[model samples]
Target chain A: MIWLTWRQHRKQALFTLIALAVVAAVMVPTGLAMHHRYERSGLAACLADLGDAQMIRQSEAAVHCQALSHQFQQQYSDLAFVAILFVILPVFVGLFFGAPLVAREVEQGTHRLVWTQSVSRRRWALTKFGLVGGVTVVLAVLYAVGVSWWFGPLVTASSGRMGYLSFDVQGVAPVGYTLFAVALGVFAGTLWRKVLPAMGAALVGFAAVRLTVETLARPRYMSPKTLTFSPQSVLRPNPATGDWVYGQGVRDAAGHLVASGAQIGPCAPPGCGGVAAGSYNWQLYQPGSRFWEFQAIETGIFLALTVLLVALAIRRLRDIA
Target chain B: MTTNDQGAHTMELALETGALGKRYGRAWALRDCSLHLPAGRVAALVGPNGAGKTTLLHLAVGLLRPDAGQVRVFGRDPRDDTSVLAEIGFVAQDTPLYRDFTAVDLIRMGGKLNRRWDAPLARDRLASLGIPPDRPVGRLSGGQRAQVALALALAKRPRLLLLDEPIASLDPLARREFMQALMGAVAESGTTVLLSSHLLADLERACDYLIVLQTARVQLVGAVDDLLAQHRTLVGPRSTDTGTPRGVVSVVRARHTDRQSTLLVRRDDDAVIDPAWIEHDVTLEDLVLAYLAEADTRATRTAWEVTA
Candidate 1:
């Protein structure tokens, strides 16, 4: 069974490696260029003080190179390209790997032969799940390593901001999500017993779940907190309700201070006038906080959901007409 | 013809159905289809379009579940018995070979997937048929594909072979050749076979036992020679009298030609043919048709009786 599974997945496995190579081929040069630019721009030294850069130099060239590196960090923080790759890989996996896994057999009526063989339906399903699911995890991990390498210089540059939700998260989420999608594809193929419909259902279904997570779940982690304080040169109490208004300014209709004060939210939503406290605005948020925790929790949740979907798929295969 | 203990032991039947039935929603594909095929005999399931012959074969091979009753292959439930399945080879209708695999690949697949496969036999058969192993199964002509499918089935070295319209898509000459090869293989291996076919002539050539189906029911089933012996057609004038003789198993059809009465009847020895009518020997084909016609009349009469 394992050999059969390996034979079945060998093509997709090669395709994945080739695709990853292409992505790396393009991103590697861009990454190296950015690293050179940031080091030349002194941004490398600036961030290097916060992190590590074994290749640091203090010349004009190094400062400009460092600036390019910093710029790359700032510009690609969203990891938009990598995120799109991650978001889309699962659909392709489901279409190429999951849909054909069962639908072809059912359509061609070869499943009858398989079912009647010495292998039971449960064993067949288990073998497929173990083999394909193992491949998905391995592929996901490989993708993570490749993208992580491309983002290596920047992640080290950004210090901690690059860890939980930056390009790393976007790039790695696809791996996890594709695992989920493959499971979904199996379920759809087994239930529908056809390829096109199964592909559509798996793609649409996974996309919906991903979109929902991105919208409602992701923002909670991305939103920054703000805290405010006023100097003794202006510190005073509020006349109304006797609440101490530290910055000695009139409160606005929206309950904000009329002037500069502490603001604790993800970077004051454009046009809001305020100064946040507890660390200079220029300083990056401290890493290893609730942010990393959220990422760990979210990943665990997605992986669990993927397992559940795959279990349902296995059950469906056993009872398929 | 052996006396007591001197006789050879009779082998157990390879397949047995007890009132087996299958239905697709309101339509009964097969109903009360009971049969028994002992080891080392070739039985042909003969029926017209939509006669549930394929349904019966599917049930017996465990590819389908019966709506009622049971199917046993070699004394074990067809669907639940892995040991039985390991010994049964089936060539489904249309010969669903993998389109992507070469003939060699498919043959190798059979060897790898099946526990009892004979790879040497498969290769030798393909070589004999001039189907080079390297050619993709999809590239082969329909006749070649059928031969490949037959090789795969045979290479399993199965004790029982079940085929559903195995030669339905082949040309006439190819069909004959395939049948000949199949008969040769069966004769050499002594494998029991149950194949469904609409071609009565082909079935006549290959089958020693016959199971005829019509209108979702088994109309007649017995050894081909036995059925021919038991049934005869009588023709005279159209029976103006509605009453049928007591021993008449059935009146196959009624026709009026120039005031002469003709009746095709299945009867016991007690049902004497009228001296005015002519009694003729019935071929197996004639016997099958008479049974089908008799079934149709019975169905129509029952429907009217219920309505009345």
Candidate 2:
């Protein structure tokens, strides 16, 4: 069964490996260059000292670091698009490899040949799904590692890792996403039984699920922690820690949360003209320390959905005739 | 039960069905089709288009589930047991082969999927047919592709082979060649075969047992020679008025001209004949066509009665 799976899908597997190799070839040199620049410019030390009051007070050091950060950001800014492409990579896997896995066989009437063999339909489906899905996950993990390593310097210097774009493409999320997408493709293929239509439906279905999870489900996994500070403090989240700031607002002395960008005059007490004495602004955020927790939660969701879809696909095979 | 050459009593039927049926949405593709084909016979399932021939064959191979009843191959439900599946080989209606796979790849796939795959026989058959093993199946001609499908099915070395319209699309020469190779395989292996074809001439040439299906029902099932002997065409004057013969199974067809009446009847015995009537032997083709035509007229009459 393993040999049969390999023989049938070696083309897809080879192309995927070559594509990953190409990505590695392009990223390795560029990543090394970025690391060399980070070391030479001393931006690492500057970033490390960003929390020091004296470093911020030193205008010359601040200016130099800002210039270095700008250069690094400019050089690696294209990686943001690459991250977006990485986000769509699983959809491509679902569309091309996953969709055609069963749909093409059905459309060409070859399932009659394969399913009627000594291998039972359930076994055949399982072998194909397991083998292809396992390979997809491995490739996705490799891609995640490569992209994360290539963008490590940029992430440390400019954008912290907890942002939307970085959160998804790094760590174990991409593997989960790939698995979910492949399962979605198989389910769609089983339902549609036509290759192109199955691919289209899988693409649309994957996008909907991904977007719903990212926008609606992921944030509510844990109630965000809130921190209150005087209005004199910076209005933005702490840049040193890459916490995902959900929202910020001001609260009056009575502890009622006020709309953001509201007139502070109503709540400002005596001697609070320059900085509000009574009204304090609060930050609602998921902290960077919970990155692994979030990854585990999101990956679990995708994997559970993947298992459901695979089970559905297998069950549906019995009714195919 | 019958004793084989080894003196072992055997009651195993190659295929059997009881009230078997299948439906596609509101329409029944096959309905209440019960049949039995004993082992070691070349049986042909003859039907018109949409007459449920393919449905019956698919059911026997467990490619399809029956909606109403059961299909048993080799004395057990083919769908429920892996052992039953292992003993039966099937080539579906379209002769579907993976277009991208080379002949060798298909053989390799067979070897991987089947426990009793005969790799050497497959390779040798392709070689003897002058089919290049390395060429992708898509590049092969239709006839060659059909041959490859046959080779794959034969290489499984199953006790029963089910072919659904295996040669429907082939030219006459290719059809003869395919049947010849199939017959040769059957002779060597003593395999039971259930083949479906709409071409009566093909069935006449290759099949000893005949099953005629029409309108999703079994119209006739018997050995070819027995069916021919049981059905006789009687020609007489229109006024003879042989209302209904005794010991008749069914009046298959009746036509009356100005002064002559022709009737095809299924009878149990060699009854005494009317002196004025001439009895002629029925060919397999004529017998099948008569049954199909009779079935169609009966269906139409039933529809008319319902409307009335």
Best by lDDT: 2
Question: TM-score for chain A of every candidate model?
Answer: 0.69, 0.87
Off by over 4 Å in 2: A50-71, A233-237, A255-277, B1-11, B239-242, B273-276, B301-308
Residue B134 in candidate 2, Cα distance off native in Å: 1.6
Mind giving the per-residue lDDT tens digits that candidate 2 earns over A1-321? 888888778888788778878877877898898889888878788777666221124346666776788887887788657767877888898887789988998999898898888988888888889888878877888878987887778877775777888888888999999899889999999999999999999999999999999999999989899877665433324354667878777787777876674423222234456543477766678887788999999999999999999999998888776
- The reply for model 1, stretches above 4 Å from the true place, is A6-10, A35-70, A73-79, A152-173, A217-288, A318-321, B1-11, B240-242, B252-258, B269-276, B293-308
DockQ, each predicted model: 0.37, 0.73
Interface RMSD of each: 2.4, 1.2
User: What is the DockQ of the complex in model 2?
Assistant: 0.73
Candidate 2 chain A: worst 10 consecutive residues by lDDT? A262-271
